[model samples]
Target: MNVSTATVSLALRDSPLVAEQTRERIKDHARAIGYIYNRRAASLRTSRSGIVGVVVHDIMNPFFAEILKAIESELDRSRQTFILSNHYDQLEKQRTFIDTLLQLGADGVIMSPAIGTPPEDIIVAEENGLPAVLIARTVEGAQVPVFRGDDAYGTALATNHLISLGHKRIAMVGGTDQTSTGRDRYHGYLGAMEKAGLPVDPAWRISGPRTKQGGFEAAGQFLALKDKPTAACCWNDLVAIGLMNGISRAGLVPGVDVSVTGYDDLEEAAIATPALTTVWNGQREVGRQAARALLDKLSGASVKPSQELIRPELHVRQSTARPVERS
Candidate 1:
């Protein structure tokens, strides 16, 4: 109480200008007296709400779960509060979340934009002084920094792994042609097939899926084909795992009866019953780097807008093997 108001202010803010012992004493006394710091007042003066908004397609998905955990750890270290939201690939939902963040004066946002998100949507956020960084999917003409794995290269790696294991008739399962990521993965699979000197029937390409349920449903059609594929290169781990379950439900042993490959080497992949073979799409790396970039931007650090593509690695396990000879 003897200290001047200026001293109290500096000590409360933990300003280094205050002596360590003095700052400790002041904080102790404040705690004893039950003095609560007004965060709203501090934010009003600094124009920094210390709130970061994160939006992804689905938080419940293991792929996003890993990414979000990494981002959360990084933000926690910086003492930033993060709000999470899921747009479920809905444009209206994504827009609503962004609007709410803007209203709260959020310092920044890291988003895996919804399908069909236009460049102007991102631009509009920046125009409103809400800086944004992208992850996973990208919007065409959006000049903001985006962090994601190399989708085309990642899928090619998965497809090639299957091919190398003697899977000549490989079917790509569970992904839509609507998003750039989907298109990239499909192209990668197609390119790998062509390069391997393998024939790909147009019927082998099954589009419009990115979830486990979708993959599970696709399994019926996959197994019913007159020329059933010996292996399926799934869009992601969720699809791969689901399809495996479906294969089992259809009275077929997955690893032995049919080979399967998935993108995104999720944590669950190693523990799956058949142990999935997959491409490590660097979900954690994407999250960490995106969070760092957004924090840097908020601190007025010069962060150049560009795309950072993380290289993918293939992890082989028990799921892939030589294609069974069907007489």
Candidate 2:
């Protein structure tokens, strides 16, 4: 009770300089007295808000949701508060979030950058003292640590699986080439097709669909193809599930009439009517590693600016099988 004011202050801040027992005693007494610690005042004094920012394309997307869960767990373990933003691939929205984080004096950021995000945006953020770690996407020349699955390799695995099922005519549905992820996935599909000596018709690469609705709408166009493909390799699990539903609505059995493969083995993929054959893209690993990298940067540890690609595994399920030729 007679501890110095300096000791009480340090104990209230949970500073390591204060003995743990003393800190606990002080916190208990403060709570008993209804004394609320002003975090704003503490941050002004220590120049650390204990806050981190995370911005991604879409929080509603299960892929990002999985990643966020890991990030939240890791940050919580370190006693950090995190702010999340969904840019929806809008560069302006991403920039606004970054700017807000900076204004709020956030300790660091972990972002799965928006499509069309220029390297300068990252550079400026770093220059302004907002250390950032990237996940699920890359910005060239950003000179920051990036954590993501090997998109090219992951999609290649899906394409090769379809090839193994003897699908000579395969369609790649969903996704656009506006971001590194999109380009990598498309190239992966293209490369795998070429490696298998399978012809990739120009019409087989259906772009601009990254959601369930998009995939559902694309089904009619896909079904109407003069030389309809026997299989579709979708950009993600959501698209694959949607496409499978569309196939069902059209009275075609998805696994039988048209084999489908998906990327990102989201939880829902395993429960779909014909359980989806998908690529495990390591979303949680991406989130956890990215959070650690940023925390390391915040702690004044040297984190190399490099890309860490988590290897993906293929999960075979009911959705893909030997193709059934249709009239």
lDDT for each candidate structure: 0.92, 0.92
- Tell me how far the alpha carbon of residue 2 in candidate 1 is from the true structure, in angstroms, after superposition: 6.1
Candidate 1 Cα outliers beyond 4 Å, as residue runs: 2-6, 16-25
Instruction: Give the 10-residue window scoring lowest on summed lDDT in candidate 1.
Output: 206-215
Model 2 clash tally, residue pairs: 0
For 1-327, candidate 2 gives per-residue lDDT tens digits of 889989999898789999999999999999999997788878888789999999988887888988999999999999999999999889999999999999888999999889889999999999998999999889998999999999999999999999998999999999989888999999999999999998889999899888888888888888998789999999998889889889999999999999999999999999999999999999989989999899899999999999999999999999999988655
Residue-wise C-alpha lDDT for candidate 1, range 1-327, written one tens digit per residue: 699988999998899999999999999999999998887778888788999999998898888988999999999999999999999999999999999999888999999999999999999999998999999887889889999999999899989988888889999998888888899899999999999999999898887667789888888989998789999999998899989999999999999999999999988999997999999998899999999999999989988889999999999999999988978
Give candidate 2 regions above 4 Å deviation. Answer: 1-4, 13-28
